[model samples]
Target: MLNLNQDPQIILWALTKDTYWHPDDHWQAVDRRCKELSTGEIFAVIDDIVHHFVHAPVVILTGKNVWQREDFDQILGKMAPILPSAIALNNPRLSHAALLSRWKDLGLTSVYLRLQNPRTLHGRQTVALAEAVVDHGMRLEIMTAVTPRTLPWLPGLADLMLSVGAASWQLGFNESLQRSKLDAKTLEQTLVWVADFAATSPLRVLPIGAPQYQRIVSDRYPLLDAGRIALREARGIAYINHHGLVYPGVNLPFAGGNLRQSSFSNIYRESPTFCALRDPRPLEGRCGFCDYHLTCGGSRTRAFRETGKLYAEDPGCWNPQTA
Candidate 1:
């Protein structure tokens, strides 16, 4: 069930810094170093979220290669009782059915596969892993970055994910590693295409760091009925990096507070970062003048990346007339 009351519903936790497949040189928003938190540290974060937040958030376990750690299964076993969680991995070893069965036994509701290089042999393994995840009665999600190289494959990719019984497919832009080659018109066209695709397909298409998608799609679909994909940063989502630092969203790098120092609930309710992100009135330029500012304030991460201001207009937003 999706939490529709504006309380936090999703929390992304960077479980480890060790990556097994490829580095996020072309996609990550902030550069993360090699640092792995101890099981105690992980448990403390989980407990804070459980005790502080108004509701139990669906914790999404993330890392470059979370499965690289030998004790990860043990860690998951301990964390499951506190809150429901899902795991994301980039390992080809996930194609094995036994491993998926083990994760199912561990009480994971879903499994996310980060398909970075979907044009290579790793892509094939990801497909196999997706099938195995569904076969084992666990939900499967495919997450990939939208780059110049990957853009052309999206239509086909959507078809592939649908064929494999994937529950959702998330597409996000490259924020820091490299400047995006895609322009405003290009992005708008892409979102329009996705909007059209989503209306008829059963598979959910989610866009990260591109909240403008909501405004674009709202022209055709009812905004309230658009599902959780319409939700934006600080509205019902938060991110915790490997160091236990909390942020408004996955791509938004501004930190509210550190779990090691303060309670998650206090920071979430009182921090300037969280407060600013939640209230769209402070946005400047086009974002402030747009009619959909309250519900779809253009991506704050993209604004920061392009203009060095968190509240600046999204450079990729192609909306001509301002409200």
Candidate 2:
């Protein structure tokens, strides 16, 4: 079940790990919260992230599942050469061999399907869904959001996902911005349960969009001192929302610059807000004093949300000394 107030020191790498995909959701909008990107803007942002050392070539494309434009394949054709590893999140409505063959032709290495529909993950369709991904020779990563309602079922869900041949399962904790949040105690317990359960499971269980827990990710999460605030969210796992508003992540609403006017690299490297986040001088509390501040500065987003300070102590951390 749930472990209470577990020692975070012994299991830093067991929980957090490096994210292989750079989430570029706003690139192409599908609905109200989604934003569309031009062909020029797409390449421009990719160039920016790589040049700025903010991210690698691999990117996570989230937004509209369906790419209706005929030119969509053309755009991917251009990026395929530069991006060797690209993961697209798609709906699991169709799992036929023909659809799988089509996805393989699109230069996609992985297809992330959300297991939100209880019927999909738990129903008889589970086996078929897993077979479609595996038979297609594409890595399958299943994602599901963890909310107050879903907390208790997470452990069982992870097991079921693995049973279906899911290569990885991403448990996304609900965001306060979405009118949902799990308390620190409950969150820690949940993580402990996951880490313990997945420690032996063949399946890879990862926190959705979180890099702060990299230390606990076994041997997977790199221990590079790459400036967590900038690398993980701001620069590394940067978020460019619809309307071209750029931030380190959603937690910090301050826009670095609009993608419409300034280039992504220029905005990422030159923006005062972004630059300050990369700088380690102003970090406060344990993050400021620790040697791991550059690489493990807790979560700037969480700090901003809880303390309203760019460099404050992370509320999720009970003993900064353990870090």
Candidate 3:
């Protein structure tokens, strides 16, 4: 009764917790004191990965100061024996050349950094980290939150992204902070602008939580073969918190199961929440009847955040149509 073949290609493992600063609180882990995964716990996860996906999925080790643990480099060394890894760090202090060189030596392929508000000095530091990541022969992926305060930074942000040689950029709305949230019209316009910008730039521009990006890109450039334009959340993208609880996406708080409690494959294949999310036929409102339901299932997390129902229509989608 379920399709067990939808294996995840990427997993964000938050092995540590830091103080949360971004409006999208569920998205980033930094600046706070919290529990961290132990060496044994981490290896169990790695072991599960080996036996789970058809091919090894990219694992992103993220949190405040992951290197704070003295055993972190050793952890990297252990993971190297099994799978290559990357890390997402937000601390400016940890972006120095020496540490980055060590990360490269450990077989890290990329670095993920966040730039919440690029106007401040901290924003510049975030950009500097991006440059450092590129200088060290590693891929750089920059993620930023889209708030009313950050919307105007688009042009300047694009310029900085080019200067830093970033490989990809992920932009998501600040769904946590009420005052900073974008209206439906503004969200649609922003996605369209990003879609147009992505067409000419070498950078992969992904609207983190906005599934409407798929419909916008397809409708705008119906002639070009743009490939798949959807958020790969429940459809093969997942997140795991420090406690080993697996989620459909970084922003999607619904957990499939805990790695310590069960095998990763079982949770992914049998979780009701996961199964429902992957099958968009039961989606309600505009999303259910939309032509792009297969590709753009809409943001189920955003729907749950606003309407208290997982199957509700995405508030950010502007398509006023029905089947």
Candidate 4:
């Protein structure tokens, strides 16, 4: 079990497609989910999960550009009906000052800007925006889609730096590799570059998805052990679409396809090393010395679908001794 002094600090939900979907349809789904959940229930669940995982705050990211103040206000108004705890503005086309002003007015706690593909700004402009965010006193997060070759030259300006895709993973599973059809060595090089960048930066590095997490934990854990990168400082955050399944505490599975075939259960199962020990009953397993048990409950739906039992032995359990 991991010994964590602090609780999980943040719970960010990527409400990406909502910006592209029709507002009413998007809201209806959200309303239905929250209909039976009282304010106290909602807060309790959120707090419990956050506390268990040591997460600090919760935020929602809208994957769209806000071009004007009115556009920002409109998005906030629409968001108000849903009453999300926080908001992350992604790829805003507006100037830094304008975006910051609007975010402040909306009472947003955090804002994430993508440094990977800046359509409107150059490197200098990106640096200026980071400066403006610090000036405005808004919590800042940065997303990078650059490889090691390109990243070193870019200014180190973000508080939290997120690798947008599987740049740190092995070749076959990396979407970028599939797009470029690169070899394994090239993929390894890119992962090394990411590690090198993280080694130099004080900002936290987050892997984008589950594949990246698998590769990092399996292949790159050695690199971390060698002190080439800080595994403790590196984290993972997944983006789930509407089809994704929600596990009460761990993560919302959104890898694609039916939840059953996604390996959600295999990767996160109830065991001494895997289950959230604090809440073992929910998972119906014993995992000793696992500090993350309560905070990192196994994927509930995945276990159900894989084993045909809601709270039974996790078919995905890999560590037989613990099982």
lDDT by candidate, in order shown? 0.74, 0.56, 0.74, 0.39
Tell me the RMSD of model 2 versus the true structure.
8.9
**Candidate number achieving the greatest TM-score relative to the actual structure:** 3
Task: Please give, for residues 17-121, the per-residue lDDT of candidate 4 as tens digits.
Answer: 334322245544763463232233333443444334533334354433323323445545444333334444454434656757766667665556555533335
**Could you tell which candidate, 1 or 3, scores higher by TM-score?**
3
Provide the clash count, candidate 3: 5
Report the number of clashing residue pairs per model.
Answer: 0, 16, 5, 17
* TM-scores, each model vs. reference: 0.85, 0.70, 0.87, 0.45
Q: Could you give the candidate ranking by TM-score, starting with the highest?
A: 3, 1, 2, 4
Residue 21 in candidate 1 has what lDDT?
A: 24
The sequence of per-residue lDDT tens digits that candidate 3 reaches over residues 122-212 is 8777876777789889988888879887889887898888878998888967543254478877888898899899888988787777777
Evaluation by lDDT, superior candidate among 2 and 3: 3
Stretches of candidate 3 exceeding 4 Å from the true structure:
1-5, 18-35, 80-84, 176-179, 223-229, 320-323
